[model samples]
Target chain A: MILQVAKSFILESIRNTGVFLGNLLPAFIFIICSWICTISIKSSPETLDFMIKGQFFPISIMLLVFAFAFSSATIYLADLKANNTIHLLKRTNISPAKYFLGIGLGVFLMMNFVLLLLLAGYSFIISLSISALISIILICNFVLLAIYPLCFIVAGIVKNGKVAQSLLVPIMLVFMFSITMTSLFLTINEQQPQDYYIYLIWNPMLYLSDTLQFQLNLNDHTWLPLYQYSIILTILCMVLSIFAKQIYIRQD
Target chain B: MLILDKVQKSYQNHSVLNGISSTFQYGHCYLLLGDNGAGKSTLLKCIAGDEKVDHGSIRGNEHEDVSNLVALQYQFFESYSFLKVKEVIQLFTKLIANPSNIKDLYELLDIAQYEKTLIKNTSGGQRKALSLYLAFLMSKPIVLLDEPFADLDLKKKKQLFGFLQNQVHLQNKCLIIISHEIKGLESLFDFVYIMQDGQFIEHGTTEELVEKYKNPTFSGLEAVYFEVTGQLLGGRIK
Candidate 1:
């Protein structure tokens, strides 16, 4: 039953014309930006790396947050409003734990699939090496997993898809501005060791972009260990999952 | 068999069901007559486990769980997606594990063509019929229908009443139907329960109640409803 529910949700998300367009449009924008970045630079290898490095973190955060919110939060809330199955399931033999697990698993798989496709396109165009590609994938996976549970959290609070999408707007905007500002600062100086940047240590996006940079030997970070971020992300995801269950109970 | 003991329910501070106790046996149809706020739907929801009782025990047969217990067709049945009629029937068929043929259900509702139509595009009467079809297909021993005849035309209403009569008389599913028009249903139901101010005051077999009250003017269901519930037939009982 869990697998059946999860598969149905995934299929529904993929088939929703709006969600599909939302996913495609962003990745298309990313492609356009990357192309523009490459064409406009016309500089040496170090200069190009420095320029790309500065922009990557902010752009990745914007896209990741968008992808996660649309595929995870918006679609889930729509299913809640439009489907009697959610209410029926609540009143059935299926436990709330199992039902939410199905939803979470579905969202995780979809976000991961979309992330891989986006990253694969970026790697193919940039001629990224094996290490850089692997590093980027790892970083993307971390942020995706960490932030994915939040969709359920938002879905639990929001009554419908449109409201859920609206609720995410402010949060996404703030994260986007912060990430962009951080990236702008990081790109300007090659001599400034990344360890001196105090703000990057606290940001999930920075962890991902920096992990990739370190993998490519493009930058260094001595401020914090990667395991610390992983631990924090894991704890946050679990708490969000538990909170989502409570919301389900309250809503029912 | 079904049993309720001291069941109470409230919304915010307004009490809907207050210490109500009733027992229903198999092979009987009961008309749950009440005024509009008399908590007919709330009682049904509590019975179906769709709403939790404030302070009481709803004990049923040991074998009955969420799926096999009472099946409810709410006043406004909302479908998750625009499912084809056949798909909805097939789903409850699987869930119930013992359902009549889809064609038979469709034909009985006088809506065989609707089987191919998306539920979203169907008319109100068609949707109501489909909701009835799904509930009947579930075939749970206990069926609670809230205004099943609403939105139905006169002909469709007669057809539904026919189908319901067959289910109660032949299949022996315990039914609690809430409707204001109790004239024709006097012969159809074995028992009549009247509700007023979230309480059941009088309940007995239709014959027993009518025979006990000798006056023809006062013996009919509308008379008993007005006498017990203290309101006109169409007045809100809440």
Candidate 2:
């Protein structure tokens, strides 16, 4: 049953040009930005090295995950709710849990596939071992898991797909700005100052960037151990999962 | 058989279903007639378990799960507009266990010609037909249809009525339909339920209700509806 629902969602997504383009836009933007950044960095080898060693690509990857969660996944779920697909499916005797799981799985697969392509492109710009690539993929999958519940919560709160779409741009811009600031601060302050760690503790995007840096051997200044980051993210995922379930079940 | 005992539902402070109690039996076609906001759709939603009632209970004799016994055709068919008709059918066919024959349903609904068309591109009548096709795709004991003939032409409506009548008499399925298109299709239903202000004003077999409320000014079920609810079949009294 879960697979069937997932298959249907995937089929619908591919058929809808707008949604399909939304899925690929992040990767395309990342590639274009990488190209422009590479062209400008050719003048100075030192700055080029700094850009490669810094949280540049990892932050981009993090933003990609956020883009998937905030835009495509949320809008699709909201569309399902707004257009009465969920209501129709409810009448078919399919459990809400199964329906949610199916959509989550579908979005997870599509996001990871895009991440894989983005990472594959990134590997050409900087040397990445097979193990490093796998670890990056694992980190991305973890980040997606942590953020997936937010899609449900947002969709549940929104009246329709139009509202979800309208909400996406401002939310994306805020997160993008915060994430970029955190990345720049981490790059300049490699000593991992305890005084500044307090300010960045609330930002999950920092943890994602730190985890990627740790994986890629780009920085050894992680404030918390890798296992600690996993535990924190897992806990957050659980809390959000509970809240999302409550909100979604309460809707119609 | 399905039963509703004092089923009550409300949205905010407004009561949509004010203690509706009724029994829907097998091999019978039940028609629910009401003006807008009269709880016809709400009652169907309650029966389908899409909406939780604030008071009382609804139960099916054969299964503990209400969804297992009831199949509902929603009034809105704008959902799943991204997928083709064939893909939508395939998706549901895969999700449902032991679905009815797809080819036959396509032909019955006369939607085979639009199998490759996206749902967004289909006409209103085509979408309605597609929604109906999906509702009957699964072979549940009870089927609840909300405005099944809303957007179809007169010919399509007559054909659908004939098909529904056959489904009830031959397959022994219980069909509960909510519709305002009752001019020429009165004989197809086994019972008529008139709703107003979230309650049933009257309910009986068409023949019995008409005979009891017979008048020279109006005819058939419309006359019975007029005398009982003091309103025309699909319009308010002047």
TM-score of each model's chain B: 0.87, 0.95
Q: Please list the C-alpha lDDT of all candidates, in the order they appear.
A: 0.67, 0.79
* Predicted structure 1, TM vs. truth: 0.78
Please estimate how well model 1 matches the true structure, expressed as its whole-model Cα lDDT: 0.67
Instruction: List TM-score per model, in order.
Output: 0.78, 0.90
For residues B1-238, could you state the per-residue lDDT of candidate 1 as single tens digits? 8888899999999999989998887788988888788888899988887778889878776635533477777666556344566665654454344565545557867766778776667877777777777767665788888777777667666766777788888888888988876555567778988887799978898887776645445558777766665666767345
DockQ of each: 0.25, 0.56
* Alpha-carbon shift of residue B82 in model 1 (angstroms): 5.5
lDDT of 2 by residue, A1-252 (tens): 888778777777778887688667764676666667777877787666456546467656866888765577888888888877887786565678888788778878777888888888887777788887786777677777777887889899998889998998887666556656655675477644333655755555666776677666766656687667777777778888999999976775
CAPRI grade, predicted model 1: acceptable
| Residue B86 in candidate 1, Cα distance off native in Å | 4.8
Error of 1 at B11 (Å): 1.8
Per-residue CA lDDT of model 1 for A1-252, tens digit only, reads 466556656655565667667766764576667667778777676666655545553365347646764445555655565545565444344565675566667766776676667767666545567766665666566676666666666776776777776776676665555655655564556435354446644455556655655655655652356677677657766776677667767766
What fraction of the true interface does each of the listed models get right, in terms of native contacts kept? 0.12, 0.63
User: Which residue pairs collide, candidate 2?
Assistant: none
